[model samples]
Target: MKQLLVPALLALLAGCATTPPTPLAPTGPKIDTTYTAKGQSSRARFLVLHYTVSDNPSSIKILTEQQVSAHYLVTNGPQPVIYRLVDENRAAYHAGVSSWKNYTQLNSSSIGIEIVNPGWTSTPEGGRLFYPFPQEQMDVLLPLLKDIVQRHGIAPENVLGHSDIAPLRKQDPGPLFPWQRLAQEGLVLWPDANRVANVRPIFEATLPDLFWFQRKLATHGFAIQQTGMLDQQTRTVLSAFQMKYRPSDFAGNPDAETAALLEVLTTPANAPLPVVPTPVTTAPVPPLPPATPPVPVVPETAPAPAAPLPVPTPVPPAPMPAPVAVPTPATPPVPAPAVVPATPAAVNTP
Candidate 1:
């Protein structure tokens, strides 16, 4: 009995000495939101572009948090992967106090795309600068933007940067972003130098009323009002405009070139839709007056005025013999004021 007890106790002690296995942590991709239903409007009119200032994990945290989120997040790694953080149908809390053209509160009407980038960094010249986006990153973005634009019937001009919409505070998808390539893809508007130059002569010859320029910018999806003065708001709008159309030289001044470029962009293009004529409800035509009966009536001729009425009442002609000569007055010569040699005020004795 003692031997059996010793063997059982030894077995229990050995089991206790062995360490327990550790459970595996949860693995695989994390999804913050899901699309339960298809979007009501398949046509996405606006594309609000942004740059992810944080790394992947940090970005995920920011987007997953209730306070902020985006529809898609494009990572900047070598392989460049895109994560759909929020369902496209739902409004992502990305755009804030924004306006574009007629669109206000763009969060309700636009798709937010966050591109992973460090944004502005310091250059050797001691100026804040941006890094070039990797080609691989753009490789993923181009197709995605194409898909979204195509599916939603988004206008080329509607695809815009975050700064474009919220210029006063945000500057994302900065100058280094490949907008020219995007324009090449038919995703946005590009100004032609020739067209801009053609209008340059006009702009330079005549000083453009600043208010008119402001109105033009506001008309083109920029958030600005015609204040008749070039204020900070106007500068912000110009800065946003420069970021998109005049990226090479964005000085935020409404110079001749910028004004001319704006005019070109706002001009109407060649597509015209057929106008349907309104259905004419012709009032029943009244029966035409039954062929007018022609009555032949002889006209009564009046007697000619009694031959040559007497040529009486001839008034006598007045005499014009008095020619009075008026005398011309001589002009007085004004004398120059006497030059006064004013004495200097007496100096006070110190």
Candidate 2:
């Protein structure tokens, strides 16, 4: 019994000796990392879409080796792959001299996605032909877009094309890009067709002046100057809008339909439709009635006194202009300055 007890005591001591000592409490300054402020939001407020205008290999090399970069890239063809070229936490040199709404220098606050596309080619007839994004590429892109948009809490209006943010200098992700598809996915805002129809007739009677178009475009988030004329910059911006929403005829003419579309988009109460609007089926503006032929003035007889020779048929008074609708409560239409000509209806497109 003594021998067995001695062996057991020795085994117990050995086990205790093998056990590690408890660690000493850390003595550095304590940082309470658990408490986080709820007032903060993501640095990325906008998602700008672009077209690389080059093949995949060229695109990859240029994006990586050059000063310009994008957060993500979607390649073209049947089996497209998505590449993350730039870290989302850092700014990419995609947007240069860009502005949207009140925000300028958008690269600092936007995530850019460069899609592999040729942008547009000029036809022999002096017309531009834009390339269409493939279905396979779109399928891959849709998921990535959804993921980023969800993670960043991006708004529908904030998903914009390259041309949209920099209308004056860029037209990438051109008319062929299926923005209507994005709208159907609830990733982008589309003007409500019904609202456009409701407002169209009013503009059809007499389209709003160029100054009005500038104000409405600014309200809809384009950084447009109110030049009060149909300038090249305004046309380019207007064309960008047309490419997204109305690709049928984007001649950049300030037509009644364009006016209606602008009004609908800028309306605070506008609820964009999730479905794609039928292409090339915008409600046609009714043709204006021909002006009443002016009555031919009979040559006055020399010194006709008492009997005014047979009174010529009296001309009817001109019809009063239709009342313009003020959809924007924030910006009531300013009375045109006297410097602005009384007759600006005859717009000269540049």
Per lDDT, the best of the predicted structures is 2
- Candidate 1: residue 132 Cα off by (Å): 2.0
Minimum summed lDDT over a 10-residue window in model 2 is located at 270-279
Instruction: List lDDT for all candidates, in order.
Output: 0.83, 0.90
Give all TM-scores, in the order shown.
0.63, 0.69
Q: For candidate 1, lDDT tens digit of each residue in 1-350?
A: 99999999999999988968678887998877766666665635799899978777788888887688899999888898889988888889899999887778999889999988888878898877777789999999999999999888888888899998889888888887899999999998777666666666777767588888888888777878789888988987787788777778776898887887887787654432223245799999899888988998989899888887688898999987898999999999999999999899998998
Give the root-mean-square deviation of each candidate in angstroms.
Answer: 26.2, 33.4
Q: Candidate 1 overall Cα lDDT vs. reference?
A: 0.83
Residue 81 CA displacement from its true place in model 1, Å: 0.4
Alpha carbon deviation, residue 201, candidate 2 (Å): 0.7
Q: Where does candidate 1 stray beyond 4 Å?
A: 1-43, 122-127, 270-350
